[model samples]
Target: MSNVSYYTAEGLKKLKEELNQLRDVERPLASQAIAEARDKGDLSENAEYDAAKEAQGLLELKIAKLEETLANARLIDESQLDTSKVLVLSTVKLRNKQNGMEMKYTLVAESEADLKSGKISVTSPIGKGLLGKKVGDTASISVPNGTLKFEILEITRN
Candidate 1:
């Protein structure tokens, strides 16, 4: 099962940076901790050794997962995208139908989604609803609260 994900250039760079940090900095630290713990006492009776071993295992698992994610990651070209409709990496400006409140969001990959940064995952309820919509198109999105309506004001590939 191969799960491919799309990301902007900046998002891909950030992912690579995190993977490098985990592999270069974190992996060595974990190994060092395990070695120091082993020098303390017998492995069977040493709680520090057990804890260190467990921590190393967890760190290795995280590194493996991150490696998998990076292996399947693809970088999207903003210039190649069509701004006529909402799509991955599309910065969409929306208007709330009821209140006329304007909001902007950048549709991104699941791992890159950050609400505080105005970036949303394409798999999210609002993102999914907004997908394939053109300017002035109304999207009825179902959320945890209920269905909410939004009008697509503009789509920019940035």
Candidate 2:
């Protein structure tokens, strides 16, 4: 099954850059380390050769996984996004019903989520709860502690 993921233009660019770094820079470094270790002595008795081979295997696995992710990634056009309701890339302003505290968050792909920057994964509990919500809509989300209610104050596309 293809696990397709959506990303903004910037997010997609970052993913591509990371894949390139892994393939171009790290791959060659791993190969060089393995070559140096192989030239030392017998393969069975050499611990350095064994470790280098293991490291190279892990690096190759990482590269393959990244390539697969890039293949399944779809770039989202911010200009074409609808602001009528909450969806991916929507910047939502929420108000906590219990404490009247207000906060803002941008719904993004899982790989692009950064809580410090107010970007949240769409699959997260709060993000799922807020999905498709409109202004003045209340979202009752179940968390580890308890159910927290949030009032959707506004939704906009940035």
Candidate 3:
């Protein structure tokens, strides 16, 4: 069975758009490239044909992966989320217990993780440790560097 993924309404919409782009645009473009390459010369000796075939295979693999992700995705209702604890799609404010540094992040599905936007995957070490924690609660997370502690300052659905 495929692992279920939790996504907010906006996240789900973005996923759907990406899937559509891959199927409607990239797939057709790949097919066209293969056809164009095939017309150039013999299949065995043509480098262009070989390259195009490899590209087509990769594109199809990507499409299949995206389709699987969509099949297992579950759209979460933000309104139904409780602000009392950190969970998927929760925007959390935290303070480093060891160094007093403050940081904020939103927990999202792996597909939606974007460090530039301060969104972290729920499967990540910090995100996993923060889940189910409430404001004023402390979480000790194990990371590649070492174990770090964080104090939750706030949790809100975004």
Candidate 4:
């Protein structure tokens, strides 16, 4: 079964680039390593040759998985996204109900999530809780530590 994943245009492009780099650069290197190791001694007794072959097999598996991911990837148009409610690709401004600390986070695909950049994956606990919530709505999210409350202050398409 194919697992379809949604990504922004930029995220899709990055995935393609990474796939290209692995196939073009890393694949060749793996092949070269195997060849060099094979030339050293008899295959049965050569530990280096065995290690190189194992590494090559791992690299091929990685390449195949990336190809599958690319095949199932879909691009999401940010312009068509609704801004009134929290959703994938929504930049939300929130206030912590307990401490009143205001913060901002952009909901994005799992591959694009970067906490330092304030982008959280839609499948995350906070993201799941914030989904479908509108401005002025309070979201009580259950986390590993405890349940935390956040007041939605604004939602934008940025």
Residue-level lDDT of model 4, residues 25-142, one tens digit each, is: 9999989998999889788999988998899899889889989988998898888888889989999999999999999999998999999999999999999999999999999999
Per-residue alpha-carbon lDDT of model 2 for 1-158, expressed as tens digits?
98999999999999999989988999899899989998997998999988988998999999898899999999888888888789999999999999999999999999999999999999999999999999989999999999999999999988
In model 4, which runs have C-alpha deviations exceeding 4 angstroms? Answer: none
lDDT of 2: 0.94
Report the Cα lDDT for candidate 1: 0.93
> Residue 102's C-alpha lDDT in candidate 4?
98
Clash totals for all models, in order? 0, 0, 0, 0
Candidate 3 residue spans exceeding 4 A from truth: none
Q: Say which candidate scores most in TM-score.
A: 2
Worst 10 residues of 1 by lDDT: 75-84
RMSD of each: 1.0, 0.8, 1.3, 1.0
CA RMSD (A), model 1: 1.0
How many clashing pairs in candidate 1?
0
Error of 1 at 19 (Å): 0.9
What TM-score quantifies how close candidate 3 is to the native fold? 0.93
RMSD of 4: 1.0
